[model samples]
Target: MNLIKYTSIAAIFVSTSLIIAKILTYHFSHSIAILSSLVDSSLDLLTSLINCVAIFYAAKPKDEDHKFGHSAIEDIASFIQAMIIFISGILIIYQASMNIVNHKVITFEKVSMYTMLLSLFMTICLVLLQKYTISKTKSLVISADCLHYKTDVLMNIGIIASLFILKFTHFYAIDSIVAICIAVYIIYSAFELGKSAFNNLMGREISRQEQDEIIAIIQAENRIKGFHDFKTRRSGQMSFIQIHIEMKGDLTLFTAHEICEEIEQKITEKIPNCEIIIHKDPC
Candidate 1:
C-alpha cells in the first residue's frame, strides 16, 4: 500500500511539473505540435490527480456497509480518466485540423525543443518508477497512470522531432500533420485503457494461467476427491477466488474443515494477497 501511495504522489508531481513546462513552451513556440504535447501533458496532470485520490480511497478497509472494500473505485477513476483522454484527443485533432486549413505560420526557438527534451527525460524516469511499482503492487490506478505517462513519452518525442524538422525545412504544414498523428495515437491509447478498466468493472475473471495454478493446487490435495464451481475475479490489487471441494461423506465435520483450511493455505501461498472461499461438499 505504501508503494502504491508513494508512486501515485510521485506521478502527480511529475505530471504537474510537465504541464507547467509545456504551457510555457507552447506559449512561445506557437506550434500546433507543441500544443499537442501541451494538451497531453495537461490531461496527464488531470489523470494523475484523479489517480492519487482513487489510490487513497481504494486503500480503505472494508466496512459493514461495503463488504467488498473500496478497491473498485480505482476502476471507476480509470474509466473517467479514459473518457477525459478520449475527449482531449478529439480536441487536439480539431485544433490541428484548423491549423492545417488556415495554413497558419508557426514559429519556435531552441527553448521549445529543450522543453520537450526535458519532458521526455522526466517522463522516462517516472515511467521506470511506475513500472517498478506496478510489478510490486499490481495496482490498477497506478497502472492506468503509467499508461498515461507512456503515451506522453511518445508525444514528447513526436513534438521534439516536429520542432527540429520545422526548424530545418520550415514546411509549416508538418506541424499540424504531426499533431494529428499524435492525436490519433492518443485516442488509440484511450481506447485501450478504457477497455481494460471496463473489463474489471464488469467483473472479468482472472487470467487463465492463474486459474490453472489454482486448479493444480487444489488437485495436489489427495484427501479431496474433486473440485468444482471455481470462480475468480479481480478488484484493484485484490483477487477473490471461490471454489467447492469434494471429500468423503463419512469424514467428521472438523476433519472436513481442517482439510479446507489446508487447501486455503496452499492457495494463499500460491497467490499472494488473494481472498479464497472454499465450500466443502460430500463426494
Candidate 2:
C-alpha cells in the first residue's frame, strides 16, 4: 500500500481502539469527563472510517471522470472530517453545560483515570506516527489525522487535570468549564482545517519558497531569456506546474526541445513527484 493508505489504516486502528477503550472506561466509572472523551473518540472513529474510504478513492488514477486526478478527494475528505469535529465540539459544549447546570459530580475511579491516561498515551503515539508519515509523504489527509490526535492530546490533558481538581476540591463546575474550553479549541481547529482544505480545493498557489526555487532554476539556464504565465496547483502528492519560457529566436526547434527537457529534469529533481510543462516562446 501507498503511504496514504498505510497511514490511514493505522489511524483507523488507533481510533477504533480508542473508541472501544473509552466505552469501557465510561461503563466502569460513568464519569462526565470520560463521557466527554468517549464523544470525541466516537467521532474520531467515524471520521477515520470515512478517511480510509476517501483515501482509497483519492488514490485512484485519473479517469475520464476525473481528468485532474482523484487527489482533490483528500481535501474533500479533510473538510468532512473537520465538519464532524465541529459537530462533536458543539455537542460536547452542550453536554458539558447541562452537566454543570445540573451540578452533576463526576466520579473518577482508578479504572477510569488509568484508562483515560492510557488512551492519551496511545493517542500521543499515533500522533507521532502520523507526523512522521506526513513529513515523508506530505499527505493532507494524514496530516489532518495527526491534527485530530494532537487536539485529543490537549483535551485528554485538560480532562485529566479537571478530574483531579474536581476530585480534590469537590468543585464539579471545573469539569464542565474544562470541557467547554476543549470544545472551543476543537471548533477553532476545525475552522482552520476546513479553511485550509477549502483553499486547496479552490486552487491555491504553491508556496512562495517553492515558486522562488522554480524561478531560480529556470533563470539559471542561459538559454532561457525569461519566463511568464507561470501556474501551479496540487492534488495529493502530485503537483502540476506550467510556465512560458522565452528563448532566443535563433534557437532551433530541436535545441528548444532539449532545453525544455533539461528544465523539466531540473524541476523534477528539485521537487519530487512534480509534473512540469513548458511553453516555449521565441524572444
Candidate 3:
C-alpha cells in the first residue's frame, strides 16, 4: 500500500482511540474542555473514513469512463472534509458560548488529566506519521491530512492548558474561552483547505518554478526552435503538461517523432509522476 493509504488507516485508528479516551474523561469530569476534545476527535474519525475511501478511488488507474483519471477525486474529498470541519467549528463555538453564558463550571478530575496526556501523546505520533507520508508522496490530500493532525496537536495542548488553569486558578471560564479559540482556529483552517481544493478543481495553474524549469528543458534541445501554448495542471500527485513545439519544416516525420519522444522522456525525468504531451508545429 502507498503512504497515503497507510496514513489514512493510522489516522482512523488514532482518532477512534482518542474519541474513546475523550468519552471516558468527559464521563468522569463533565468538563466542557474534555467534551470539546471529543467533538474534535469525532470529526477526525469522520474525515479519516472519507479519506480512506477517497484514497482508494484516487489510486485507481485511468479508465475509459474517466479519460482524464480519477486522481482529482482526492481534491473533492478534501473539500468535503473542509465543509465538515467548518460545521463542527460552528457547533463548537455555539456550545462554548452557551457554557460561558450559563456559568457552567468544569471540575477537573485526575482521569481527565490522564486522558489528556494520552491524547497529546497520540497526536504527536500522528503528526510524525503525517510528516513522513507527506515527504514520501508530496500529495496535497496527505498534506491537508497532516495539517489537520497538526491542528489537533495545538488544540490538545490548549485543552490541557485549560485543564491546568482550571485546576490551579479555579477559573472555569478559561475553559470555554479556550474552546472558543480552538473553534475559530479550526474554522480558519477549513476555509484555507477548502479554497485550495476548490482552486484545484477549477484548473489552477502549476507553480512558476515548475513552469520555468519545463520551458528551460525544452528550449535547451537543439532540435526544438521555440515553443508556445504551454500549459500545466495537477490531479492528486500527477502533473499534466501540454506544449506546442516549433521544429524545422525540412525534418522528416520520423525524426520529429523521435524528438518529441526524447522531450517527453526528459520532462518525465525532471518531474516524476508527470504526463507530457508534445504537439509539433513547423517553424
> For candidate 1, what is the lDDT?
0.85
* Candidate 1 residue-wise lDDT, 194-258, digit = tens: 89789888999988988998899888889999998999998766789999999999999999999
Highest lDDT against the true fold, candidate: 3
Worst ten-residue run, lDDT, model 3? 135-144
**Model 3 RMSD in angstroms:** 2.0
Position 187, candidate 1: lDDT: 92
Count residue pairs with overlapping backbones in model 3: 0
**Cα lDDT for residue 208, model 2?**
86
Clashes of each: 0, 0, 0
Decreasing lDDT order of the candidates: 3, 1, 2
- Worst 10-residue lDDT window for candidate 1 reads 139-148
Clashing pairs in 3: none
Q: Relative to the unseen true structure, what is the C-alpha lDDT of residue 26 in candidate 2, on a scale of 0 to 100?
A: 80
Worst 10-residue lDDT window for candidate 2 reads: 104-113
